[model samples]
Target chain A: METKIKEIIKQVKKGDQSAFEDVVTFYQNKVYQICFRVIGNAHEAEDLAQETFIRAYVNIHSFDDKRKFSTWLYRIATNISIDRIRKKKPDYFLDAEVKGTDGLDMYSQLPAEQLLPEEEVESLELQSYIQQEIMQLPTKYRSVIALRFVDELSLAEISEILSIPVGTVKTRIHRGREALRKRLRRV
Target chain B: MSCNKQFINLMHKYLDGELTRTDENLLRSHLHSCQSCQKHFHELKRTTTLLKSSSELQPSSNFTEKVMASLPKEKKRVGYMRWFKAHPVITAAAIFFIFMFSSVFSAWDQDSQLSVSKDKNLIIQEDTVIVPEGVTVDGDLVVKNGNLKIDGSVNGNVVIINGEHLMASAGEISGEIEQVNQVFEWMWYHIKDITKNLFAFTNK
Candidate 1:
């Protein structure tokens, strides 16, 4: 898959429009998923996803081949998501820690175990519940959680995509998990 | 390390199987006796599991098509403006050279040829040359540093240097006619004459 994507990117660099369409097809879902998870809206996510590809197309020449193409695409998608979120909610702070109902930092909350069985029906409900709580996390924590868990990206990969240190990525993931655990415990 | 702090710090790494053998043993021993730490570990594990299990949202059916449609057209070739933008120094240099060449060429003196008239009616005064009526100059007529008054026919080219040529209603010039009256025009003419004479002497 990596080799295929690299070829597609090379073709795109050579001004092959059809190869660009292939790229858009390959990354559309993943990019849309990232945007949707970060922005938490279907319409806005679609718009941002489209905008991300548009930006990628326009600036495709700046892409470095030494790095993973997915990482580059994720960077564009995540930055666009962050920008759109910031634009929509001017009062939201990325650096500030989100607090739960107990007046403690959400990330500092204790982790909890799954109290229900592994029934498929209950699992779906739990999944939905977890996603809602994930959405409620602070923007920074939500982004890391989405990239870490939803996208199943490695900490180093997340670091590269977000342009942060690996230690910071691990810390954000830990905090994001704790926040979700605390929120789920209430339910 | 203290058991509680150690457990708290290593809980994530432990679930992720990133702990070393010694730390893993220590955490396991600690979890056996510590219910709070064990519960926290289970919860964190469950949280990550649920997060991983969440389904990725699929975009609309036409999502890729829409994205492709929205993409701006690829700039396949370097346009003149884009080349100019990229090579600003070269563009500026070219423009400067063109301007300089045009200015120099425009300022260069234009040469005027002279021929004396053999006609009897041609009158040459101190500062004015006049061709009276019913007279025809058979050769090229050139008036230098003076005005020319023509009332008859001239069979050759008529040129005036540092002066004006006034032609009456009945006057006729059979060849090309020109006037050079500017100060720079005179300088240009003298420079051109000197260069020609020098070239001719060099050839000789």
Candidate 2:
């Protein structure tokens, strides 16, 4: 399946618009999720997602076939978000490129019925609490946490995205979670 | 068999289904006895479940429409060559590299041509100066009444005032000076000769 995508990518690099669209359709959701996790917003994620595909289009010729297409795409998205964050002081998710009034904020109230069962609600509350605590973490920890959990990418994939070694990725995820658990304890 | 650090580590892998049987049994034994670890495990389980159950945000119903709208009119193929050439930075870099290469080669060709011309002039007036091979004249080679023949290369200028000059196969002159046959009476000839000889001797 991936080999087929690889072939499609080669065709896309040859200036095939249909192939490019295929690439976009294949990776849009994953790219959006990554942008959302990194930027912490939906609108930005959507915009960044589109931007990632545009960038991939621009630099497709430079894409080496030895690496996984997904890995390459993730690297592009991660870098774009990181660069955007460094240049701008963002109040919301970096992925939120689009400014929409209807978009949900992290603090928006959940409907009563939609809430977890009483015991589970406490856990959900604790998870949300943990997320809030995570937001207070340094960018390094926050990035690792979001990549590890929210994006659900492998440690190796996260390492590639961050341009760090796998060991560093592992350590970051470990320490980031530990920090979250510690913060949760305080609450 | 409690919520010790080891069990904590095990829980991380356990949640990911990475624990071996022995490690799994160890964690299970620890969990059975330890309330805190059990609670922590439950919390982890709950969190992951909640995360999974959380509603995902899809792009708007017209999301694909919006995306397609933002894109240019769909074409089956694009002229990549024109696109690549239109990139000012890349084009500038390429032009810069080409200019540098041409400049370097031009210098080399000029130097080689200059040497070839000088060597030819040395052969043309071979009656006056005998320049030995393997000697290089560092400056100009000029033959007038005096003969200059080279079996070796010269490292300095070669000038024959009213003489013939011969540059053998190994002879080379790299610098510049004047070659004149008609001795127009002037106060400058002696001074120029002194300066040229001084420079030539120093180079040797």
Candidate 3:
């Protein structure tokens, strides 16, 4: 895996755009997952993911070979997500669906009807409920929950990706989950 | 770690299915005995289960294509080989730089040439001579039976022969400013007479 990443980096340096596409394909799902969890919306997550790739493409030369590619990607995504939050400053955490470029509500395109009708109904209900409850979490805990559980990144991976201590990751995850449980019970 | 904090951290790991068998067993043993941790662990599990079972929203199938479409075209990068083969924009820029370089050097060359020619007894018959300002010329200035005035300034020796030379009061020749009147000198008369006699002798 290390050898392959190095080769991809080399190809990127050689101006091989296709090699960059391969890097995008390999990390897209993980990147999208992180974006979605951080922002808690599909459309914004997709936009952020696209922007992340574009940023990576423009700045590929700065990538350090000694570091993990995944870590570098997450760092880019995390910074972008943080910037979005700082800009939006929604009332109820980052879950508010602002109008998109086309002037249509971004979250309105969710897959509410695609799931088996009964599950679809339940899923929509649960999604909204989860969003509200997750929003109630302290931002730090909220971030941990989003990065760890929603994104499915390992505690160690989250620590490395966020540049926080491993102990901090574990503590945040625990506290975040605890706070989330309280929010859900209240609902 | 104490069973209290260990229970909470392990509960998070267990909910995420990241706990190993040994840790899971230890956590379960602790939870069974500790009612508070047990209650917290159970509730944490239930809520996380709810989140996991929540709608797994993948972006539209066209998502990647849409992103690709939103991006500007890949900009068919010209490889080194093709870059040299002739691109209109590149060619234009190259031509512009060449013109600029030549003009800059030509202007410098012309200025130097004009200063040198001014010192020589050669008169600039045409307005083609371009003497850039602030340059010094060291020689004599003799505009024989013509005008003589320095346009701007002269710092070094100013020697001119036969033509008008303008030295604005601002013009200061650091070297001696000597304007010898050479309407007809002894050397010129002797040389002319000898040349005329030589022609007569050659005819004989």
- Report the CAPRI category for model 2: incorrect
Give native contacts recovered, as a fraction, per prediction: 0.84, 0.07, 0.31
Instruction: Give candidate 3's root-mean-square deviation (CA, Å).
Output: 15.8
TM-score (chain B) of candidate 3: 0.31
Per-residue accuracy of model 3 over B10-95 as CA lDDT, tens digit each: 87788656789999999878878888887787788787776655336565666666555554444555355346565778877888
Per-model RMSD to reference: 10.5, 14.4, 15.8
What TM-score does model 1 achieve against the real structure?
0.60
Per-residue lDDT of model 2, residues B175-194, tens digit only: 44345444342114544555
What TM-score quantifies how close candidate 3 is to the native fold? 0.53
Query: TM-score per candidate, in order?
Result: 0.60, 0.53, 0.53
lDDT tens per residue, model 3, A1-187: 7579789978976677667766776677777766776776778988898999888877777998888787788889878987887788754422343455321122224432233355345554666667655654444555666667655677888888778898888877776676567657644
Best by DockQ: 1
DockQ (CA atoms), all models: 0.55, 0.17, 0.30
- lDDT tens readout by residue for model 2, A1-187: 7899999988876666666767776667667766665665568768887888777777787899988888888888878877767777655453232346322233233331233465344544543444445554445555666666655778877887788898777666655555445445434
- Model 1 over residues B1-204: C-alpha lDDT tens digits? 234566777888865557899988888888899888788888878777777774647778898888877777655364466578779999999997688556645544343333333436778776677898888888777676667888888898877876678655469889978786776665566566567889999999
Candidate numbers sorted by lDDT from highest down: 1, 3, 2
Candidate 1 residues A108-156, lDDT tens each? 3324333334423444454455665666667777778777765678888
